[model samples]
Target: MQHTNILIISDIEGSSLCRDYESTTFLGRGWPRACLGMSKDVNAVVRALYNAGAREVTVQDFHRTGFNIFPEIIDKRARVVQGYRQGPVPGIGRAHGATGLVMTGMHAPSGADAILAHTLTSRIARLEVNGRLMTEAELFCASLAPFGLVPLFISGCPTACDYAANAIDGLTSFPLHQEIRGSEARAMTWREQMAAAAAAALKSPAGRPFNPKGPFEAKVTLRKGSGEAQKLAARWNLEAHGPQVTIQARDLNRIYLELVRLVYLNRFTQHVLPPGLFLYRIMGRLGLAWIRRQLKNLPPSLR
Candidate 1:
């Protein structure tokens, strides 16, 4: 049977970017756990695509530092792109060229007040382009639209699901948990979510993505202590706060590249992690972490 070239953009290991978790605010923490489960999520998606007549499955380990996808656990046939610095930067089409794509363990844009509401950094107060709100996931997915690649499946916490369903069409989601207050409240087991994801993904097909023109308004508000605001302002005149700066972009990828550069600078000034990472691996870590935690919590009978 021939396999389709399906790319899964994951941010499981990226859940720590929220910096809200008691465990992962610090760099290099909580990523290993997320990567393990992200590997399985990749497998589950691959299982479905292979069963549904896919030819290839490539999972982008899009999370922190961008290189956390554990190749040992991921299906040997699937390709994993890890880390941000080593990637084309997280934006649409960066993961394009696939027959179809899946965005797993995603979250809402930093503009909205979802649990971890920050685009690139908590330092970023907000990201707006041409009066529309923008999140890293949205920017990343929108980037894919230009490549004519459709995102078919997405999984993560409820917020992640809600974000994907609203942003990308024909994209189904597997919501792992509902956040109440701060901690995980109503959660779905990883196996259950994966099973459900596989079952729900059976009927999906590729759809057109959002490919809009730029020179669009781009704005970002940074957190206190992050000079990213001024640095970004120097690039383009938009807006600035004590810890924020906004810019306008004629190119989405251009803006994305700018963000990537800024993030690297931030890391250099702060915590030192891996050197080369890609787009897919950075975000996959976050959602994958949530998925695996459920698997660990599963009762023996359930397993």
Candidate 2:
């Protein structure tokens, strides 16, 4: 109806299709980059919003390390929020401060039939705390709804786009590709997805917001046999009860940040196979001690 300030939270880049090194069904070498949709989707939405009367826009490169999306490729006119080490919550804060939000390049929850599909980590089975099914898109949109920021557009794989649209009604979703099997996809060009996303985003009658009634519950289910199970068990200072873990976030900021930390800590395991590859790459293995120390030493503002 009027000019708006938009924010984009996305996992812009995913590694090249595993080079077919892991499984036989995996996508071919560099068939595509996971971040491509994010880069393209955001650009499309930015242009659409600007035409639709957006005054300004900020794109939050909200991944674990917060380092996706090439600057040159991203909409130069929009501000980019990067880096993973931004304290507790890695990505954007409350959308309470923004006019609108958009999510792209995000995959489905761990169980979805998408390439590199895992909720928090390969170890996480599901994360549905406080009654809400928590995907990065859900968690982020939920946090923003309270602040009056509606997620208006989304683009990614089939499961990913559906996951987002279901979470936020009235929002436009363009599924870039369909993950037919692990590492394999029935390709949908980024241009096609972006065009659809742009058309949908700029369409006059926006869809209804799938805003859930709150008092939100935070839950997490990790992969069955990943090392992150051990890490979360220790980080939250709880018992390692197989692959499932649960936690609570009282407010939007808390919920969003906690999810980031979950992704951040779980980052240790994302490379060799699944996300757990981050485990070997992390310095000091990013153990529970670090989480404990930080939790114990958190500042009043953060806490």
Candidate 3:
């Protein structure tokens, strides 16, 4: 069957009402509230798309564990894609025939001076494709291009909006928050404005795909203290250039997969841990907290 689906890729750090590590972290103190805010922001865009005559909407939970959104609170008309899955994109697959892609709650790339800014993970200090610096949005857009989908709109902070506008030609964007200084931002509570902007964007002409001509050369710069870079360099047969690892691939799919493998390789245990092993969960949380604290203490210039 032919489908006119709009794929909404949602992240937490760029949500309208989100602020601080507690809001973005899965098990942090303010996570519940952040989840609710993210759900509402997604639903607003979903409803707007439906109202604008979109046949279907799919909300991809693109945050931690791919399960941050509350299923019950999201728009019932939209199907939700949750959990970690293997694909060119985390929640996207070959079966999706999305007419447009909407990146909701997306933050800026690492080193971009936005609230909670980082690329795929805190460990990745920089990512470049063919020596061009990339934002997470650009990477995902390149992945979706094979499916003939183009980015239509993005909702996030002002930095995110500017990044999308600059990266994807003719793309529309709504800034739900504006960064004041460092991690502080002023939230824009106008859901109606966001909805209207998104609806209009979907109806407008699609933006140019961000795909780069391949064979692709990717360089990943790891944070100074992260040991994962050495491990990844050995596993991928890549050359370690101080803090950076260089990987070459013939296509975007290989590049995407390699990056994912590097970032989440250490967390494989979390998926296999038995639910009843509550002690392991506590240990994992403490370990993650320690790692984050260390990342925070890294020279601000590198972060």
Candidate 4:
């Protein structure tokens, strides 16, 4: 029998244990506790896969900066890929004989009611590939096509789970929470339940790959009032109409590259900012906290 190896791609927003922006934001008030919960969730699935007889398991921290998952608390049996990386799939290079992919802590696309819902980044208001609305799960699944691996399991909010299941045939999805309104959601299951579901999904047959045909056309709608949209359009030669930008490519890889450029265009500031700039950090924290509070106070209908 062939030894099965699996790759786990994890995010933090869809974690049932995470309830607020502070928990998912890096260096925010509840970030440490949220990181611990995210680590435990990843570790749970890792141990389950090992118990189910998987020889090797690798985890890719697919969240902000790609370093959200705590290395110290992760399962020793599983190797983890952390930090920022570039490619069709950031932080994930060659699949390396992995038979399956598991997406954990995923949320719905932008404008959805799932907790911290956003595609690629909060800067994007909407994203469409080849005229079809694209989600992070779909993009990652297509990127893994060259390696012949498929998304075997996904654990996330209900909307995200449904999206993945609908996009990939035979894909198993475990819902950690159901979004009630905007960032508000109710946890549906505990960490142990999620682990069991993931292991069972992995042991099942491999899911079909969701590989879209080539000659992809990507349409990205930047968030309203964004200051970077004009600059991005000028730099990339993208066709811009108001907040929307379009990139035409012959393949998915190029489309992915274009989207990456748009998403991280302003991220370079982090590299130049002095480490001792405590005041700036404090201001940013306050601003983010205020925005989160406003979102929390929004009516359910508006959310």
- Candidate with maximal lDDT: 4
What shift in Å separates residue 260 of candidate 4 from its native position after superposition? 0.4
Q: Which stretches of candidate 2 lie over 4 Å from their true place?
A: 13-38, 84-90, 94-97, 129-133, 179-196, 199-211, 214-219, 224-231, 234-241, 248-303
RMSD of each: 6.3, 11.7, 7.7, 7.2
Task: Estimate the TM-score for candidate 3.
Answer: 0.79
Q: How many steric overlaps are in each model, in order?
A: 58, 38, 0, 0
Q: Candidate 4 regions off by >4 Å?
A: 1-3, 178-189, 225-227, 266-303
Q: How far is candidate 3 from the true structure (C-alpha RMSD, Å)?
A: 7.7
lDDT of all predictions, in order shown?
Answer: 0.56, 0.53, 0.71, 0.71
Candidate 3: the clashing residue pairs are none
RMSD of 4: 7.2
lDDT (Cα, tens digit) per residue for candidate 1, span 1-303: 121677777765223112234323323344334444455566666666666666677777665545545566765767765544333534322554575667766665667767655666656666676675676666676666656566666666566567657756676766655432112221224544564665456456545555556686565656543466666655544466656565556877667666655544453532443432233354556645554565476444432
For model 1, what is the alpha-carbon lDDT of residue 138? 63
Report residue 140 deviation for candidate 2 (angstroms): 1.0
Q: Least lDDT summed over 10 consecutive residues: which range in candidate 3?
A: 180-189
lDDT assessment of candidate 2: 0.53
Give the local distance difference test score of model 3.
Answer: 0.71
lDDT of 4 by residue, 182-237 (tens): 22222323667788888887656656555766888887888864355677887768
Q: Of the candidates numbered 1 and 2, which has the greater TM-score value?
A: 1
* Order of the predicted models by TM-score, top scorer first: 3, 4, 1, 2
